[model samples]
Target: MKFKALTLGILIASAGASQAATVNEVFNGKMLGTNQRYFESIAGVPRDSFRNDHTFVVQNCQITATIGDGKVTALRLDLGQGCEANLQSFIGEDAPKPGQTITPGVFGSGQRYTASCLAECGNAADPSAYALWQAPRSAGGMEVLMEMVLAGDKAMTAADEWEKQIKQAAGMDYVLATKFNCETRFNSIAEAVFKDVPVNAITVGYGLPTQRCN
Candidate 1:
């Protein structure tokens, strides 16, 4: 039950109510990794000033688990600016140049990285999400594909286990209240929580054009 095509097929195939249920599972169950130090440091930094640390500066990350056919097919770990920068190094670029931005995303910091463990979630032909996140082909870079295959019974528990690790390593709370869904799941979570579709459209999930580590 991998998510070979990241499209709306599941939403159309499954009943609205069922798709909604799956969305709720993904929303409420998804855990957010915290960034205690980042928030703490944010308070200290001046409102207009910026800090430069060629490493992951943020203190939190998030996970979204989409269930299909009675199993978790996709588990996307949305990295914070800091996390994204940290991982930039692994793909290729590890440091920031004279005028380039490195306080956020770059390869070497290892701050942000997406690990797609399952083969059924993104492109079945390509089982790893790492490829999708990798540098573009034109840049002579690899693509980071979505990999979410490690969510079986025992492995599924890893999501919960990560909460404890987050607390211990980062000394922060991991209670999450927000989730991003395309439509089926998005509408479902909104209906379950607010009893309707989300309006006012405040962007709270991933894929922003800009970000910061600290």
Candidate 2:
């Protein structure tokens, strides 16, 4: 279920699609629109790399992320069932404006921060997508990963349920890199609605890099 031998370091470095955007370039407010694409995490890799967060509603169909340097290095997204219909049903009204200070977790204003969450979407710049470029790592630095779904209304009960479910059945469904004996280290994400489509959950995982690809 994982490309344990896939080396993101190398894969992301070269073989990028003529149209695929870079990770750092994508996450830093350069939100991707429809018909856009990012670099593949691995070459010839199957797109079945999906997992559930709460074992209920969040289904990660595909994901692409970048890890390294101090920067978060990429953009993110999450899709769920029934999301292909309107796409705008989930884009809530509230979004973070520039110069806005929104803190997502327990870290100080220093180690804890987020990039731009709003940049004028195709319709009205909805809070359609918000992802963690980095997370608190266990080794000695930041952590973060990319995965998606949680597309219901922003209910604390639903969020709490998803969190509890993920914690209860962590690695089994939402795993990062199990090869380097790494554990999913990324956490704390915001609701993302694409073109009005609804998303349900997100999880960032970081622990180790994939083995270098040929």
Candidate 3:
């Protein structure tokens, strides 16, 4: 009986270790620069493949890998709304929730705005509320981009209210609006815009240098 119990404990420990290893390989950017053969070995054959891009489902997250020169150059994990729990578990207790202003260096070595231009200067596709993490070279040189969705009716209502206020303050001139500034406006009402918002997607890119968001 004692021997059986000891063996069972060993088996359980081994299983847990194996699971952790797999999770690290999949989620920690270890596979970022690996070749296709190595990627398949860890992630198994992808459910879908198109040219250099391969898509796989791991831990309920849809991950897409883009290959270049026979090595994975980029990875994107889409958690969607349903995988919030999974994301929380993976990112830990400090993970940013919708409407909360994410602190710098929370998800990567550095954090920055997601848009290429300031809020009003950018086109409709520009994301108003999102964070970017560019990891150091020692940490795989991958860019981690996380984006959030607003919290239903309340978020919309808050946005409408802000727009009204902005119009009042900045008037009808686009040039006047520049004085409001993206960072300043974002800092003022980040909580209202992103309150309880869950991250729906994360994209990781390897060999990508950090560029100034002009």
Candidate 4:
């Protein structure tokens, strides 16, 4: 009986320790202002380093931290295949879904903006790729951005096809209308196509705009 009780206590302690190492717990709180050396002590030596950005693998999740002025400014986590379990752990139950109006303060950030195409809307010169949601200039000057992938090689093929159809039906008189119309149409299609797909990557920036949210 005594031996069994001792073993049970040890098992419980081990489980607690394992839970403490989760992605969220390891990366959350007071991380924005920390330095590279301090981050490496917890995240281990980076597998790749480029300028101020360092990529490290923590619990199979690829986390890249951007350091500026010797302090960490941003973190981008690529939750690829086999890292699905960590998704919920990192973002919690408020993970943004397709076509859903993301609640502000979801990631402890302020206002959120959704970009229909991968790039700026109404920009015909830019290629439409994926969908992105950005929450810039949040509390403590932090920014949060999320990305979702679209299907197919070109990804913009559907958007292009729709644009051509609109132009054919509306003629040159409606050339200006095609821009906003196609943008909205492409957003709907992207939402449907990636409804069941999870966010590919999430980036959190501190004190600056990582990707043009404003």
Candidate 5:
């Protein structure tokens, strides 16, 4: 009986480690949930004939997540290319309702706006995670933003700016296409990045979004 118990414990621990190992490989030891941010500016012709040229300033330019207690709890990454179909899987939580206005500046004061279900992904639970569509409500490249926390840490906080920027740009947001849930967000992240990352390596989540100029 003792031997059996010992063997089972070993197997369980090994399996747990194996799961995180996949997610761990990508960072190569840098740290999973750090707040280090990346962003870029993408310019484009106006989607509307009368509108000015557009500038999409994407942030956390690369997919990155927060790690806590050796698990990936949160995520931040672009939602396009091979990353599109799987947006919901990573959500790990329910998504917000479509047309839900994720007002900016919870602590500070700004009225920037970003619309979720602006396209589609899954049922949102967290209220912050989003999968956006393209111009005229097509599949604009997608992206995911989540929260993170270490074990024993208090509740996690989102990295997004609270002040409103979008509406301030003289525009309100609406979902052009689909809505999403947490799992869908998770799956999408799984599809977006370098494949070697082990599953469940992240513990907490965090997110900061980019701005668009049109």
Candidate 6:
């Protein structure tokens, strides 16, 4: 009987070790999640109606979730191909500098803006840029806020400005396309989408990071 109990204990310990190892491997960059959502952009004739320009596919974009929380929190996407120049134009000259990362949050001085840059800007049609958002912890099933494509590098800079903006921009379509409980105002954006969701006991930055952007 003692032998059987010992064996059972070992088995349980092994199982836990396996789960921890898997999560560690993913977080530490050994493995990557396979699921990714793709968004495409459309093209039209140049404002020059007389120009014989052919309409071509703009870009192929994909958003891959980095964590295993069952919802997409952070994502990575490829900006449009060979359009580094165009991308720079969209995001603008003030790109994120050394020690600067464009995350979600409110800027300083009570500015009326929420910045959500993520890697992608939020242009569903254009894959050049993308966004990542985390819904307010209170919103159940809304844990992973929204992810979207950006036009270019400029959005990257703006993303560093604030958190609310990140959520608002990344989840813009979600707010528009879906029936989420929310309140939108000129200086602020809030919603009840996360109200029903249980607030996580763990503060976001308190624990070790579970995901990393490539």
Q: After superposition, how far is residue 98 of candidate 1 from its true place, in Å?
A: 41
- State which candidate, 1 or 5, has the greater TM-score: 1
lDDT of 2 by residue, 1-214 (tens): 2464467644555445312432223322322221122323212232443321111111223334332332324323343442221111112122223223232321121221121211211343332223333432332243332222222454333333434444455543332211111223322222221112223323333342222111
Q: Rate the local accuracy (lDDT) of all candidates.
A: 0.27, 0.29, 0.53, 0.52, 0.27, 0.27
How far residue 107's Cα lies from its native spot in candidate 1, in Å, is 14
Q: Per-residue lDDT of 1-214 in model 3, one digit per residue for the tens?
A: 9999999986776556445534335654456678987776666658898987788766656777888899888776666434322223223343445434333334533355432322354345533335565555554344556654333454445444555565665664622343333444433443344433445566667444232422
Superposed Cα deviation of residue 178, candidate 6 (Å): 4.5
- For 137-214, candidate 6 gives per-residue lDDT tens digits of 442212222122233344423332333454566555543332222222423332211211111111111121322222
lDDT of 4 by residue, 36-81 (tens): 7676666666789999888877687888888888888877777555
Q: Of the candidates numbered 3 and 6, which has the greater lDDT value?
A: 3
TM-score, predicted candidate 3 vs. hidden true structure = 0.51
Per-model TM-score on C-alpha atoms: 0.21, 0.24, 0.51, 0.50, 0.20, 0.18
Better of 4 and 5 by TM-score: 4
Q: Candidate 5 residues 68-187, lDDT tens each?
A: 444433343333232211222323123223223221111122112232322223454322222232111132222232222111112111212111221233233322221122223222
Off by over 4 Å in 5: 1-62, 91-214
Error at 76, model 2, angstroms: 4.9
Backbone clashes in candidate 5 total 78
- Candidate 3's C-alpha runs over 4 A off are 1-24, 50-52, 80-110, 115-129, 136-141, 150-196, 207-214
The TM-score obtained by model 6 is 0.18
Q: What's model 1's TM-score?
A: 0.21
Number of the top lDDT candidate? 3
In terms of lDDT, model 6 sits at 0.27
